[model samples]
Target: LKAGNMVGPRVYSTGTILYGADGDFKAVINSLDDARSSLRRLKAVGAFSVKSYNQPRREQRQQIIEAARELQMEVVPEGGSNYFNNMTMILDGHTGIEHNPPVWPVYKDVKALWNATRVGYTPTLIVSYGTQFGENYWYDRTEVWKNDHLLSFTPPSVIDSRSRRRTTAEYGDYGHIDIAKSVKYIADGGTKINLGSHGQLQGLGAHWELWMLAQGGMTPMQALRCATMNGAAYLGMDKEIGSLETGKLADMVVLNENPLDDIRNSESIKYVMVNGRMYDTDSMNEIGNREKPRLRFWWQMTRGGDMINLPVNNTETHLFGVQEGD
Candidate 1:
């Protein structure tokens, strides 16, 4: 904010994780009063509430909740599989919970859950598991996502396909996050969902994260709100940058289609009005069109319009006869 050009969402950061010997940053509570004190201490420095990147068990987290009520500070507990022990972190008195959202049941009724706790959710799909989708069937859309880059980061050792009955080093088990189920679940729930594409892998993975959220369970309007309102609320900057209200930041997005009607229509963007300027999507697409033929020529030769059954070249495959001595 001081630089005058670092504009995105206003942020409230919890300085650092104060954890015990087990690296237990998410869980611990002697009492509610202690939780409140912890929140006040966090707020006194710079944060508006107490926040963490993981969740603890039910019994251990109670004290934090109790303390939060006493100090009138928000408590946000992030949830995940590897790190989060509790799924209902928001219900535990945290201002909100972070993403672990693969299930439709969880995303759809999330608003009700938030209202019930008076908190929010941060669906950071990109961070946790989006990139895990290696050469996934859906992402094979050459026009949308090319796989050349995948070959670079995706070594055989990086994959863990143990879930398959046969044990083989040939495949790594990562990718495809039950996205369809999750999308339907969250969209239908009509909750206050924010967009946070865990951003470590895909350069602009947030865009894809937001797109998936809309394609999975949110309308374009709903998904946009997740990127805007939901994120604003999660960051405690709702009054500042979440909406187009007077005195708020002059940021905007102009689209040709009603995303609310068809969330996928987001790809059909025409112009984007941001800060106070416009970006022409048509021009961007026009540039891409000129090079499309070059990119498609190889696929055209291999498949001849039959995309699904494209022949896999086996000339490179190796096979040898068993040794006679054996």
Candidate 2:
């Protein structure tokens, strides 16, 4: 509060710990009791939540979730192979999934899993970057790319195609289903719809997510909540900035159109209020820059420019005297 600013967005840092099968978590913290202690340590350090990855066994995953619960920490699981595993994590107390490819993505039953999220917020940012979405992203026409500059580049994310590694339009286009499921889940009864942009250009992909959410079935307001209020609650800050309550920080955005009627209206932000101060879009455009990549665009060579030329699944896989790839 040194800024003497009467208000500010209440922030909570999510601490993610990468653990391998034979790492320190197993070597040093071998017992279930030790796991609880480790989580407590993370909480003591101001981490609102602790996330560990690279788990290879069901037993191990369950143990971690239990240990976190014993310590009252929200458990977040990253590995998903099918709808079974996805549902298991939700039932076993995982806050939400982090990838969309693991489900092999079929919206036919996504409403079931999404319903689980209604009891809580599940950030589908994984659905946007992983799965076939990224593949479709590469296929994005020049106009589509410009329309989605965030996915074109700047979104720091990954592809969870590791589960099956199938290729085709089916590989990269389940993004639509993810949005559809998210919408149905929220409309059915969700109170919080945590929006996860998967970290790139904060504005770019985040807006895409909202737009997709609306396209998939969410009303404008429902989609807006996914990015704003719901996201705040996922971070454990429901008392501060999720709504326009008194004593809450004046953190909000002023859009040209009412999002309750059109989710895409968010892209029309004219102003932002943070810490009780207004940031006009004109001034907002002048406060930020960009970052360099840590990896040499691995997808470029591994996948080739085939992204734009790839064929859609279930439609036509072959053309005049040539396989789509050939």
Candidate 3:
């Protein structure tokens, strides 16, 4: 089947999935017949989920949910940080709500929604409310940018972008307390919260997400569950990937310290095994670290390795942009 930004019946009948469709991409399925026909067409071609981009009105969402249920398909809705849409999606029914909802005036009906339906929640804390914690808080943390494991894979430009950046506080709001408090509220009330870092900073982003979840009021175990089992269950992969069970895949991390004592310790990783293949995280740092014959740096390389002849370059140097001096 051809894949592209195809629209209309071909998108579903021929198996083209729309990743982000705001307000059902303006295709109104108002009647039951319209809903049934549309969803049945999708299911016939093996489409299982409908992704809404934070714009569907309550009735529209309800219709989508009803149609999905009748067809045994899942509706995964993203509310784009809008409080009303997020709450409505949760109430109306969904497989998961993407990212944390807006922080101000926390959603009070979350527990009711949880009791009513089996919806999953993904906070996507790192990109969504990470800056809300405070610019100074992130900047002052030595470990965020200094960790050898992170710096090994992270580009100097990415590090610079995240470092020393000012928050919206310049306009008078100095912090992200509301979002943090709301996160704590939802977790405490027993809603199934899942971890989502939005793919920022690669592997290191998950640790940052867990740390922020702890800051938001989750116990270390609860936050860890959000990172592990909750996410697996949401993706329908818990039977295989979430825990260290006998029949599950051998995927797990060996940490240097107990993350239960402090979530930040999650970053202190020693080894990671996926599908029974073990990786020395420290040794993985060396693979792309050097140019043997001549010294040319692609990105920041952690110091003190056997690649001695290769001179280390300044981490602040941008690879593409050049100024006056050589």
Checking candidate 3 for backbone clashes, the offending pairs are 132-176
lDDT of 2 by residue, 155-263 (tens): 2222222212333354335565564564455456543556665643345566766666666677777777777777677666778878888988777777788767666
Better of 2 and 3 by TM-score: 3
Quote each prediction's TM-score: 0.57, 0.65, 0.72
Would you list the clashing residue pairs of candidate 2? 132-171, 132-172, 132-173, 133-172
lDDT of 1 by residue, 202-285 (tens): 323555666666545455676787777767776767787878898876666666777667665554555444454343433221
The TM-score between candidate 2 and the true structure equals 0.65
**Tens digits of per-residue lDDT for model 3 on 1-326?**
13523211111222433223444444555566666776787778677766644334566667767888888777777657677677777777788887777655465666566646778888776656434543334555543556555555566557766764633244224234456567778667677888876666677767777877777677899889988898778766789888999999777888999988888788787866655545556544222233122222345333432232322332443444335785
- lDDT for each of the candidates? 0.49, 0.53, 0.63
Cα error, residue 27 of model 2, in Å, equals: 8.7
Q: CA RMSD for every model?
A: 11.7, 11.4, 8.0
lDDT-better candidate, 2 vs 3: 3
Measured by TM-score, the strongest candidate is 3
Q: Residue 204 deviation, candidate 1, in Å?
A: 1.4
Q: Report the number of the highest-lDDT candidate.
A: 3
